[model samples]
Target: MATFPQVDFLKEAGLKADRILVPSDADFVARQASYWSCGARSLRPACIVQPRSAREVAAAVRALVSARVPFAVRSGGHTAWASANTIGADGVTIDLGYMDWVRLPSDEEGTGKTVNLGPGNQWGRVYSELALHGLTVAGGREGNVGVAGLILGGGMAFFTGRYGLACDNIVEYEVVLADGRIVSARKDGDHANLFRALKGGSGNFGIVTNFRMRTLPLPPVWAGMTIHPKEAIPDAIRALKDFTDDMWSDPDFKDIVVIGALIQIAGVEQAPAYKKWLEMPTITTTCKMTTIPQLTMDYSQAKDYHNTWFTATFKNDVRIVAKAAELHDQLVKTLKAFIPDGDFVTQCLFQPFPRLFGQHSAAAGGNMLNIERQSHDGLLWLAVAQVRTPEQERFAYTLVQDWVHAVRQFAAIIGGNLEWTYLNYADRSQDPLTNYGLENILFMKDVAAKYDPEQVFQTLCSGGFKVSNVKLPN
Candidate 1:
């Protein structure tokens, strides 16, 4: 494969704002060099272009296409893998970090309020800004995750129970095509075909420059986390089902409870004792919540930069929750017996999908989101396997995949409807497009061909969900 080659087009393209950042540029190298995939892995881009405006981004796209160089587009750089943001050999990078401006409409103006975010901006930053006006957009739970990836692939979060996935909330998107044309798209507006294709389509469609989101007035929603002891896995697992069943049945609970087990060696000399003593006791409780408060929660605390493997959905099957808990407990017990002293943490996180509770209670089209198309009567679960060590990491990842597969099987057995997969936390092996339904997937592919007839996005762009790639089994 072709590697990064030295290029001098950045300086020529960058005009008013300090947009184009070449490899040799000190600030560019330091700012755009690192990523958050595992533990701060760094890659050198041959050319890093920071477009201050959508026009600049369009120009950068044209330059890259003319050069025939492979390019990677980065917004928040919070993607779990390097391939999503890092540049290839001799390729250019369209880093959207410089785009962090938000515009809100005053309540008195009667013009529905909305916020425009740059791709590089994270959900946390956006949330903080939105909170100033007592508003909260349905966004990803992890504050550090970028707005682009989350929305493009159907964002999942605590508010999703009442609002729906992130993609479902978007009203319009400002995107630059593979052929260097910039266009605006909305649900039923001009360029609607491209807009529909971009939703849950990953970055395969094009580089989203600025997103025009539909916003909602914020409410005083309660939030909390209740951790069950490791030893209480059996009871905790059972409780998990009861909690989600209540939410699925009532739809007003608006509660998210997570059950996690912390297994770690205490010290060098106490490693063995730590393992023996740490027998599956429930340790963290991050689940008590009612309505949101005026002040925002510390966004930085949402994640600890640890590697996480997760899968989720909205279904009214309590058995899925119970099965996940049981499987997690079994996996932990198995690890304890085999490794004897391995350090690992496993969590079964459950949150309700938005629109499950009720309506937005505010004006429509405030943000560029679509929360109206959701069926709220369901429970969504995420069986996570997390660890810090390389060996433990591999094991945890494999174990989680196995558990999710088992859960999928169990869902089928229980006559549960299996739908879309959350794209942000999806594994490389999982097929998200299929989760969107065969009809939706096929429709997205047809729409994609209309916008990008040459398959420029499928063959050239870096990574994200691709509409043209998924082949359904007959």
Candidate 2:
């Protein structure tokens, strides 16, 4: 095992002694070994540095860069890929869990309120905290997801139909650049370009220490999950398409449909479609007129299993969705036959990415997703599988890869294939940044060069998708 060369330097510097944990320390061993998703739990870093503030993070960055040692920054440890948030054997891990802070500002001018959040905070805590003040921000549907990774990678939320993505709600970002400089990027600030790049650019630019997001009033929401048997897939597909097609006119309806061994529909219940879907032969779990915090709390899934996610985007066509359902059924059978001993379950989810979502973002400051450039409203497809062990992961990966390819082919056949991909749900094997469209990719590269001229983030970060690998158009 390789050692972190800057461990001693970081300790000798102003960093607190207790904050730096070596592999020998029990706390370090536990934090290093634990991950929200099992796929990254196997990675072991040489040392773990928990920074309590952005200044400490900057100090750690300076020491690591001076010593030329590789390091990975982890916010919530929710990424499912190995080494995506966890460091390899030779690297150091900057765990920002201690920086979890959420507060409402005392001074503000507008009709709405803005909440300040720490990157280390989880969406569950943020939503819960803000709900006390009768406010909520656009955030991940799943509560356990971290604020930093999701916002940086273009987040999707139930409120995305009303507001845009989670990133679109960000008013300011306090970031630590490659040169160990801490700067604030706001829409009207000098670092505006960097601000836009950070919207969907992943971890390639810099480490965001803090996020200040605009919050909406906490409205009473009616939401829940409905389970239908496999026989309902065709009807479910048609229903979903009809709902999404109508979303342009009806912006209040938000839904996420999952097709697999069973069909699951989870979303806002106020939509008439929800009532109609509930009428089908199904097991319904209903939550009516609740706050955002309570809704997310109710829908939180278990994180104990090894998870894999792959995603694709296509036009909102019922034909394509039906084809995807067939592929999902076939993939489940193949997984059972290949890995009978593994505890594996598959999920194929379709969510509306209506043109209205993009229009909302455009109304706010634009983002790197460039959804406005797309010609039509679409559905974002995610193929997810979970297993219990490392050995099972291999079989799960192969199964998911094949399923994604089949879905892509189906979309192409229907002339509905979309170049855009939702980065938050994409697997490591997929190139989501390149699919952001050629112009956005080029703009992101320019921003990377401008903010990190030494290519420190591009070369040294070594986690998440890097802008350097984006392919240029011919």
Q: Candidate 2's residue-wise lDDT over 71-187, tens digit each?
A: 999998888788788877677888999899997776875345788899998889988888777778888777888899999998887678778889998999999999999999998
Best by lDDT: 2
Task: Give the local distance difference test score of model 2.
Answer: 0.81
* Clash count, one per candidate: 56, 0
Worst 10 residues of 1 by lDDT: 261-270
The 0-to-1 C-alpha lDDT of every candidate, in the order given, reads 0.61, 0.81
After superposition, which runs of candidate 2 have C-alpha atoms over 4 Å from their true positions?
1-4, 109-112, 259-270
Residues 34-112, model 1: lDDT tens digits? 4555422345667677777788878777767766767788877776545667765567777788887766645437444
Mark the 10 consecutive residues where model 2 has the least summed lDDT: 259-268
